[model samples]
Target: MDKSWIDWADWCSKPYRAKLEDFLNFAYVNRDPSSRIYCPCRKCENRKFFEKVIVRQHLHGNGFWKKYKIWDKHGESRDGADSLHRDEMFMGSDDYMEEDMVKVLNGWTDKSFKDLLDICNESMPEGVNLPNSYYQAQKLTEDLGFTYNTVDACPNSCMLFRNEDINLDQCLICKASRWKEDGCSLVSDLGPGKRKAAKQARYFPLKPRLQRLFMSSKIATLMRWHAEKRTDDGVFRHPADSLAWKDFDKKHPSFSGDIRNVRLGLASDGFNPFRTMNIVHSTWPVILVPYNLPPMMLMKQPFIYLSVLIDGPKGPGDKIDVYLQPLIEELKELWDEGIETFDASSNQMFQMHAALLWTINDFPAYANLSGWNTKGEYACPSCNSETASIWLPNGKKFSYGSSRRFLPYDHKYRKDPRSFNGLREYRRSPTTLSGVDLLTQLQSNGILTEYRREDLQTRQMMGLEKPEKDPLKKRKHNWKKKSIFFELPYWKDNLIRHNLDVMHIEKNVCDNVLETILGVAGKSKDNISSRRDLELMGIREQYHVKRRESGSEYFDPADFEMNNDGKDKFLIALSETRMPDGSASHIARRVRLKDRSISGLKSHDNHILLQQLIPLSIRSSLPKKVVEGLIDLGKFFKVLCSKLNCAADLEEARSRIVVTLCDLEKIFPPSFFDVMEHLPIHLVQEALIAGAVQFRWMYPIERCGE
Candidate 1:
């Protein structure tokens, strides 16, 4: 990606800029096929336009407090500068969140972010008037402090999703937009829908040489900007919460040196819980590349596997640099190539997109890189719309379902009433998670587990219902109609709440122990305090008081041992004793001091005692949280059962307890040995270790050697 190609207008304005203009024109001419050319700046004569407006009867829309502005280094508006996005409880937000976060964290009605975006992006009312361009949208945000933009179906039937101060128009100076006799080409609109889907057209009419232009920096930048969301309402509208955005940014890092390092970018609008987005010059990433880039040339449409770069101010977890490393490197490489590389920068031709695939090679202990359905296993987007597996584009027969969506391929099951628009669209071409990212995914889930143990007490509280038993099962409860308030999807997501069951989910990196009588007695490698046992690990220096009085020095093991003050050993001199882990056996009878000095001690004195350093396995932390949480959780079912109305569901709920107790035992050591006999085998140990963090999550490409 040559730097010269970056500011396309810079060269186009100069008549004699032959070499630069010639190459860029060749790359840009007739290239983009998605009909996404920059649109006309001046609103002139009327032309063909397709528009949509859907009315939403006023529902219980909960209102939020205020929204703040995100500013850049130059003091430009980031998003909604001085305005606020009122948080609505009912209608959408309620369905996605729990009662605790809604009422406790930030008081509101109830709703999910997904549903909120759907409502926010709905067709605008006919009478509402608004600004019509991207910069205008920007200006509206800066001056008016609030804004909204619209999408038109000019030449297409689908609704055009719009935003208030986002990408509504093309860059007027640059060739980001175009003008025509009847209507202007919208190729340049920076809207998420057009830019994200534009890459697909490039592949439709492929060629041998054209591929280089396709691989140009311009294309790379386009992809970088296009990666807006991890999933759900990422296309537009702010995200509902910080947890959702965190998951998004984890996938998209801010930067990397290689392709394998690519992850997803996390983005959200309204009030971001992360707070980074609301500050000055802070950025975030999201990983959600549905497919690779190759298919765009052949298929002529959007495929996943495209990462994006977003300059924050629009939402939380904003900015898209994590996906820009490759593009930036390619540009610098071209700059070094002098005149030979032909200024085909990311702006002109090679713009790229970045995203993170859900399942990669490193995460095999969980699932594959997502595929289509056979039923019962994978999520059928057309059936139940819970997790990300629904839109599995990397599989053999890639497809997407509309409305209650599901792909028609193999490996997943689909049921009605649950699935919705699973096969949303074709992922980027040849899409599959691999290279460096596959390894990173495994490392986070794997090696991280080696360090900390999560207290999953939440799961046992009956707060966590088992992860939906296959999307195919659409059984609804008659209890709600019979007088109960409502039926929850998880009834209780014990596994989600405290995650007491996932004891090793957290990691303990170090351990240290100390005794007054036996100074610096011992330390374990795993203990962070082990260094403290050596004295002040994070500190720079320490002083030894007795050393100065000794005059000869404590460095000499003989002098250091046996009472530096020249008195008899504190433990020795025929002292009283205390029962310990046998180490107290060293208490009397003229014993040598803590330090071993060959010349002054018997053979046993030289032997280092292992008892001082106590090692705790990761699994040891598991049983307590899981067991305790579950024990408390069981009472809820008992109470529900005793109520006389939940006999049937409570009866079935019996198995949940057995399964929970059994899982807890597998990862955690039981308080008793034969106690396992009284319980079911599900609670029995098949192996000492039920699950090991996969290598990829803990160790990916860049970290292979480290």
Candidate 2:
């Protein structure tokens, strides 16, 4: 166990080679010699995997990662290490002790904080003691350098009281007072020198947070994982393997030159911070996930940076762009003139630049970020002006069909009018608009006007007020305003600017399919209105409501809908089902036997149901064709949600999903195909370009906020 050779200057020396061979032999003793092992070379840093022979060669060429004396990754453990060495590593470090203390204090609640402290004090010997109070423990961890800056915001979200406006008592645009109005004061004044701001936002500066990623040698190495250790076998395990990432690299070689240059995905969603449905309030937190790290670390809470917390009693809809000012300014600086960051792993300083690859959000929030109206006839963002939608008079909502157009031209579904809407589909899939194309459209349509801080100041200086909306322009296009993200120099060139969240999409699809099949009253998509829509279309006559001689309506049962007996069997099967721990929640708890339906399922539960459970549960109850169609839909999601995918597989999935939707169209009423159902047609293509759905989805972001 003598580690003296690890520090040897001459790696080629016979002594060093002999020691390395000994270490390798010891590490790979019972394991296969040809199998991959963690290479401990200075260049590899135990991050890259290599065969034993290659690892030996790397060690000889680059020397060992000198600090990695204990080979924990290579089967060695701290328990087997010399006791004295273990004590020196842990007990001797004051910073380590303080970090451990902070972790313990963080888990303790206000009611249990004192109880935990008393227990710690009793356990420790004579003179040793833990912090006496929660505040004392908090102060102990103050040196950790975690903090947020509070900036007073206009109550109307008109502007932030920062820089030039820091001294202003009232908003220049609205003439509203900055401070909260006193309840007892008569003249909007409480005779106070300082008062609480009407609203405040927490801004966590991006530069320092990005720089801190490299301060630790362990995390510093991980930050380069996408470029360094990722397998280049054409499989999409990480975002780096995706076409969009490679395309970005090809277009911007300078940014890609350094592997350490950060690639970030922004996710912002409003949540009820109070965790109560009765209280209608929302707080939106903008989080940035650094994609430079490998899949496992990138989506984790600790690595996700909270750039801004937009305070809200009412969610900032389109006005969220105002709250994103600080973040955007920092991002602009990061992209233009990079910041100098010290990488602990390399022991050198280098300029680190970052670009926001895309944003992850649900459909409603997508409208707020992209400056597009995600409702009405032009709801589908990808489809844009070409969105295929029809208003169902009875359903009173937009039903997105015409899925046969997305099918192959030679496919029978294209010519089969009877199976789909009353007309045959010859139209091809809609063309996806490039960022440049969108920008040009916005400019031509007169919707690309500047709306940032400088524009506001310019308007104020000219003694001009905000202009009235152009009725013609509004009627002509869905463009609300050019997105604030378009201001970034590279935003236009990026392929996927904002991702469609797979989490919510999957849940919605599952709910639609499940409720309709189960015939859950009120929630089911196959209601009386849906039947009326079918009757108006003059298709599926068998399903239309018939007026009996007695005047009671007689509706024929659809193939997709389960009968009372079938419903009982389906519910019973789901209730009796057991899942692996942590895979999903208890199915029985969600199953309401009295109601004969499932309820209170969380997002993950729905994910599981969509991918695996529903397909299994429906096989015995539903008709063969209906069962096959639902199973195909389930398979599509299962493949889409995978952590690893290849281009060929995704391409096949793309074709398969189109047919699946067509088949679903034939089975369900037109009213069942909402925008959520249409979204799946594009998900496979996105997975091919953006890699696995897990990284782009809101599941991790939602869990982190909670």
Candidate 3:
């Protein structure tokens, strides 16, 4: 079709009208005249659909979108050489061709891009051609094979309108209308009226995404990096070097036989999409990282596949399993019945299987994923029901202690009482539960034997029904419900099913130490209440609050507390310190000299401060014992976070951390030892099993979201 009429200045001309009629006939073709087609008006921009008459009226009134020359969405296609040749015409004559095009395309409308192209074509030699507009240029590189399915969900998260419930207008369980209640016109009027869904989840299918990885020759080779190119030395560098990975291979030889088989790590967390504290909304996104790639490229944004996006004004919480239904179903299929993937590097089709090795999340999210409560008494997932916790009445929180039990049986710290909670530690470390032990406990508790056989068997797999509870009965266990991942055949057998985020643990520990030592008003853990807790525990007497004759109480300064001068000097030292560019954000700006406190530190900032700055800055001002403990803590993190670590170093660090925690117990009040401070003890064991912390940590996942 002749598109010269698009360049005509006058829309009223007879020649333009004749060309417009010809274009309309071409667009309509054999279709019904009443059928709606995408409007090419400036206002609509092919987003709105209109009847043929309304579309013609829109084109006449607003003019055809000048850049839509190819008309791909409107049933027109460039044939033969024309289709393949247009992409080359738009290629920029520069080394940074893609970058240059992106710069030109930024904020440009279709007509603006077309006008620029017209200027370029007119100035260039007669034989040269260019892509008519931005849309045409974009089509050349866009992967139309990748798409997301929008599944309507109940506003209350009861069920998704899918499969058996596909045509249902309302939720089967909740009986709530599937369509939005707001009075708005249906989106597409030509078809049976379809209202906007009340709530919807976007599921990017895992099968095609995984297949696309093998379609590229470079990526296809990289997908087998773990098995093919990785060094098999005992040193820990990648997930493949981990004991868990090896154990999985030993158990399932058939799955590991193909180096092309994918191993994936799942990570999820809720973030405020609006990026404001005032907005009371949470949106959860589930991301998957393929561990089959080498360590260098594994966590990069390009390889991070966002499989499911759960839209939320409120987080799904335990009901997140409802949203994970599609992804889990695809994973099940991938594991049982492999997908036929064509490998560009090998030039052959192969059956590809994938298994979710583990999930990575923060403490609160750990509860949602693993169905283990990470709060109250049984807060430690590693320790399970044997978590050593004591209620601090004055501090109004649970203070976790008993690090001495983890120490060697004959270790000197086990005999010393004053250094810890003023009692001898005779108990052994809490028993580590195996997969069989966990299943046995669940069965004995009636979770698997009764609930699984009855409720789970009767209802839909992904249905959101709260487990029945007696109103007056006291809860005896921390197990919320069996995790959705356990439905997978091999979930229970995996050594590590869920991971503890080292990033959050480091940040919390840093905050506690920094705030308490500096005595940052309300933020300090060593407040009046903490001193009273020490008095209640009948330990650390010198640090207890003393009553004055005037009926006011004054607490004695602990060894960790810094005087005003010390605080000033410490703050000033941190403020004056400079780091290499890109090594860290500007730490100087976060230090408040007048306030004598550090503020507005992000997770990575805290990581740098804890690992590098605090040990250096506090040595001059703090007591020798306090400084030594802080330094040991810092060194523990520095070694644990190393890119390459040996088993001997981790084993030694494990014993060293026990002594560090014992020393800290002597210095800081009992209230200082929250779950975060004690969690470091278990981190080494996890690292020993999972290899480097980098592969399983939340830093890459959190940064990718940003």
Candidate 4:
């Protein structure tokens, strides 16, 4: 952060600075406790000595890198010109330059650059070593063609001040100045103006970055793994092969025509870099991931490319659409005109077309992007049909409230005596088949409709008319109009346009399970009602019960409460125990629930809950059927997370999730549904199509907000 470090150092010695006697006294005063100063001469080199005589002798002589001729031969040196020539000689040649660069690249750091020239002066090289400065190394890297594509943007979350608007002085939307008016000359002068300048986000075009990926032959070939190397076998190896994908492909034949065209998945979320959870200010980064890679390499961070940073003191929220304008414009171009790209593997330049296959995000982000109400009962994205919900005793209502009725249409829970009598018999009618049809149905609602059907008014005309009082209520009435996704010409199909982030979903489900079990109010601990239910399930004695002063029983569930096995006993047990599929298993790592932090339970903890702990450890305590159902769910998640060659197991896993969701009454307590309705729509749609087992899971964006 300091500018002084960037200044170049002078190599020549000062003329007549001090006579030999004065220099000797000055050097003696600066000597260490051992009465010796370090010698910089070629022979006496940088070594601490007990004798002051040795240090003085070295200073009078020439060092390998530091020539003494500059000082001693000052009068005969053509006013330091001949001494300067000799100084160059002391510096090494091109051969040693290569070795220096290798060291620079491998051991480069902030301090390394600052001390580079100093290190060269200290080095006693046998051969000529070039005196390479920090700037020279930077110039070398630039000559090697290292560059980044950067575009300026308005400090406010307005349009990019790029292209035709590059010369504009102010933003069109917010009227914010394109550049800071008060240009500070010194670091001391930098205050509010510099802070404002810092807020101006930079846009890095993803097109060039994607092209660069193809420059590396090893990575270039891996980019085509999904299309060429992966075995299809009619399974869901990638989203391209999913049922939703195939449906979209069927609807738009021309778009899916080129198998070689790149497919991209977009993802974005707001977060506070400061790690202060309650802070309202957050930075949002829009990221694009190439889905052409295999499952193992897909989610890796290095492969994830940043398209833009939405600089902020506050999150963009619903207004995230404004920041996405540039991305959307680029995407439209990529989809339509394509780009001329060089492929290293094929060793040729080709026209590469890229499409945003889908977006991956948590529920809140998905809702912000898709304009779907994830909080409502009709939250199911696949089927816009009405879902069953019930008013609970807690003065709140929940969908799939009754566990007995939580199953698939044909599931036996519909007849189970414990299920809501006659309630399970209610059947819902089907809704529209496509997003277009769904939009039509929503538009027919009188409150949202700008004009009557008989009036024969267009939507544009409706917008011109003054709305009735209570505009906020009207806006609330029609969430569809607020959604930008419906307007995108490319992403017409709502079902497959956005994807559920698998990471968030698994983390959310795990949090719910752990919260209820651990009895932590805000974390993955079990709620009071869930604990009471567990008591009713006939395992109350597993915990410790204390007699209070009032002679009433006080339950302290710590005895049975789940804790992290500090020694990883659970992991050992899981590894040794035979799984239901008769496979020997090794979990990635041991998850410790007890090691709680401000973020509540971590991903690894949730992983353990779903994969090993729930399936293997809690079998005896819970009902046999419930244990089996949980194990089934866990296995499905495990398969989904795995990197399999074929989609056979993936499809089967998806189907099992739907079935497991249907049997939730047997698997989990009723309180879980209170949180289920708010899950992202992608999970709901995927479940409806693949068999209703998977959609019941929740997304974990709230964890980030916390």
Q: Identify the candidate with maximal lDDT.
A: 2
* Model 4: per-residue Cα lDDT over 1-706, one tens digit each: 1112112133123321123334445434423324333354456444443245654455444422243332321111323222323323323444345655666447767456547656765664432234456566545433333333355555544455566776666666556666555554432246534523424554667677777778666788887775678765664445555566557567667766755577776777877766666766788877777766766666566677777677777776655665666677777787788888878777777777787756667667776666554555455444444444543343243434443332356766666544322234435333435666656655665323211222213332444223233242333332433444444565666456666555667767766654554444554333444445444433434332446899876655443234444124433453344444423223323333344321334565566567766677655444566557667767766765553324445445545665576565443444465534223223434533322122112222223233
lDDT of 1 by residue, 1-706 (tens): 2333323433233432453334334323333322111111112111111111100000001111112112111122223232112211111223222422344355433344334334533543322223332333335333422222222211111111223313433321122322112235343444444443221000111111123333345553333332432233322111111232333344434422222112221111122334454555422222222221221221122322222222223321101121222333333332232122122332232223222212222111111111122232223211222212222222212121221111232213223221222123322212222223323433343311100112112222323213353222243210000000001111121111100111111111101111211232432111222222222212212221124654643322211112333222333322333336743334244344444211222212211111111111111222355334334333322332121222234334333444443333222111111111121111111001111112112212112211
Model 2 lDDT tens row, 1-706: 8888999999998888889888987776656556576788999898777777788899889988989977766765433443322221222136435545565546657447666666776775432346666666555444344567899988877788999889888887667788887676423365555577888899988888898899778999999888778999999988999899999999999999999999999999999977789999989999999998877787998888889998879877776888888888899999999999888787788999999999999999998899887877888989898988989999999999888888778988888878778888888889989999998888877564234766555545654333344342346456665688988999999999989999999999998888999988998889889999988988888889899899987688888999988888898999999998887889789988788888888899899998888898888899999999999999999988888789998899999999899999999999899999999998987888888788999999999877
Candidate 2: clashing pairs of residues: none
Output the better candidate (1/4) by TM-score. Answer: 4
TM-score of each: 0.18, 0.81, 0.80, 0.61
Give the per-residue lDDT of model 3 (tens digit) for 197-220: 878899988988898899778999
Worst 10 residues of 2 by lDDT: 83-92
Which stretch of 10 consecutive residues in model 3 shows the poorest summed lDDT?
78-87
Ranking by TM-score: 2, 3, 4, 1
Candidate 1 lDDT trough over 10 residues, lowest sum: 477-486
Candidate 4 lDDT trough over 10 residues, lowest sum: 1-10
